[model samples]
Target: MTIPHFISIGHITHDLVGNGITPGGPALYSTCAARNLGISVGMITSFSRPLLQPGLLQGIDIRCQESQKTTTFANLYNEHGERRQIIESVADRITSTLIPPEWRAVSIVNICPVANEYLPEIVRLFDKALIGICPQGWMRRWDSKGQVFRKKWENFKEVLPYADIVFFSEEDVSDPKKAVETYLPYTKMVIVTQGKLGASIYSHNGVHRSPAFPTIEVDPTGAGDVFATAFLIRYFETHDVPESARFANCVASFVVEKEGIYGIPGLDDVKRRLNVAR
Candidate 1:
């Protein structure tokens, strides 16, 4: 089999909100976003067999490690759009061994953990690829009661050096300024996404700001994952950080206009938005 161009490694989650249940996690959102960009994508994820809908991953090359229960989360939103997350259950961690031998050399590798299920050592497996990390899961810790809280990523120094770029949201860090200062030296690029304000890219060249495109916001569920995947794809193609951020912002603008994965924009959709922005 031909190797996929993009690979997303993480947990496939069951996200509960009010009366609705949806398939989530960065693995789902990132892979779908890559596919929307016309890239051949693959996934290395752990989930409960019965809980997953194969149709949701139809065209991708999937290596699913079955766990007794899928990692699950319940999100409660406040009037101001702040979120409180509760972990219902968790799946198995993804080790380097679970990664297909062929996929190790993919053009792009996205380490997108949702429950701290991905090991930091997995970064060494893809030495030749542009490794992009979305480390929200690693920065999180949950109590026995399953209330999730922000925690310092103990392995940041060990893993960030190997990553080409790191993506995280403002809400993911307790001290945004400190987090940026800590990780900026380890990676070539660091992006802190700020919802409607867009994203800021930190590099040796200084911070480059990308403004978010205006749209009717419906759901912000997977916008960060969408932005990260889109940014990496554009960065790989152009090697222009500012341009990539702008393109990614345009792509993610569509994702928030609808709920679930329904708003993941295709290449044409992004192109239309890009054209309008120009």
Candidate 2:
């Protein structure tokens, strides 16, 4: 089996925006960001559609468990730009048994559960790789009408101890600082993204604030996923937390200026923007 440098496991979603249905989810966005940064990437997901669409992460390895329905979300934005989501459909859960043996040794692993499709035990599947957890999906609950709402991550203790780093948006929790405080005891590092306001990083060393790069915001769909992906990739390479946060913020700035995967930038483009931001 060909081992990729990065691996993201979750359910790839079909998101409803305006009158169009687009492929989305953290796993897909992370793979696109990883590929643009010139890293060999692999994704494990459960989807009903063709896993690799035309012009989407063409060369990356994507493993799929054929499912009856793809995880779907209808995004409704208010006049103030806040988003309200409805779960239109859902795919199958990604079980540990679906993971390939060789892929366990990948350098960086991102367990991105976009719709609560992952079990907490799946975090233990990796050995020494840096495991980044994006738990928005785990923190969500929907009603009979499928309206999404934030709920406590009931089994966070079961998973956080095994993760090297945890990333989430301020909107994902009631209080971002308290959420970071809650996660720091179990994980080595915790990052709470505040969109245009920037991000905060908490680690053993101390808390560092990384400012966002100014850009015209087009769509905020996968900005957090791209930020987490860039941070993990850069941190894995250099082990510099402050530098990684700044680089991540710069990379994510580009993604929000465009729609969906088209916003994911190459390393050179990111470097240029990083230099300008400095």
Candidate 3:
């Protein structure tokens, strides 16, 4: 079997809003984004049997550890773009032992935890790959009622050093600026994504800005995952942080124009936007 070039480890979520339910999580978005970029993608995830749709992840290789319940989240959004999330149910935690030994050696690995499903020790497994992190999950804490709130990532030092790049949205932390500063010493690159205002990239050369591509707003559910996936794919190819961020911004622009997974852009769609931007 051909090993995948890109792998995303997290939970495949069941997102509930009102009467509607859709599959979500960083694993779904990032894997789809990577596959659309012509990268061979795989996912290591957990979900209940009832929530598992056989062909939902058609193109990507998936290894699922069965769980009693799929991670379920209900997101309540206000007119001002503020969101309140409630965790209805959570899936099983994923650890290094669950990963296939052969698949551990890959070109890129995205550690995307949606509900703290992924263990920090898993980061030490990929010594040769360019490991990227979408740490929104780690920065969150839930009450006994499952209402979600932002929390400082206490284990940042342990996991950040193993990552080549780390991605997070402005709202993921209490202070985005300080979060970036805290993680910079451990990781090679830090990306703080601000919805319409664009993103900021911090590296050894200091901070640089990447402008967002213009588009009509729809759903912003998976935009950050899309951006992070596209950024890692482009960064692996070009090794230019600014260029990668710009390319990622272009790809993510299309995601916000539609709802759910329908917004993920294909290579042709990304190129078309890039051409127009140029």
Candidate 2, residue 68: Cα displacement in angstroms equals: 1.0
Screening candidate 3 with a backbone cut-off below 3 angstroms (N, C-alpha, C), the clashing residue pairs are none
List where candidate 3 sits over 4 angstroms from the true fold: 50-55
lDDT of 3 by residue, 1-278 (tens): 77899999999898885688878899988998998888999999989853435666778998888899999999888998788999989999887777788887899999999999877888999898999999888889899999999998988899988889999999898788898888999989999999998899999889999999999988888999999999999999999888999999999999989867778888998998888878
Model 1 pairs in collision: none
lDDT of 2 by residue, 84-139 (tens): 99998999988877888999899999989999897889989888799999998999
Which model is ahead, 2 or 3, in terms of lDDT?
Answer: 2
Sliding window of 10 residues with minimal summed lDDT for model 1: 49-58
TM-score for all predictions?
Answer: 0.97, 0.97, 0.97
Model 1: residue 10 alpha-carbon error in angstroms: 0.4
lDDT of each: 0.89, 0.90, 0.89
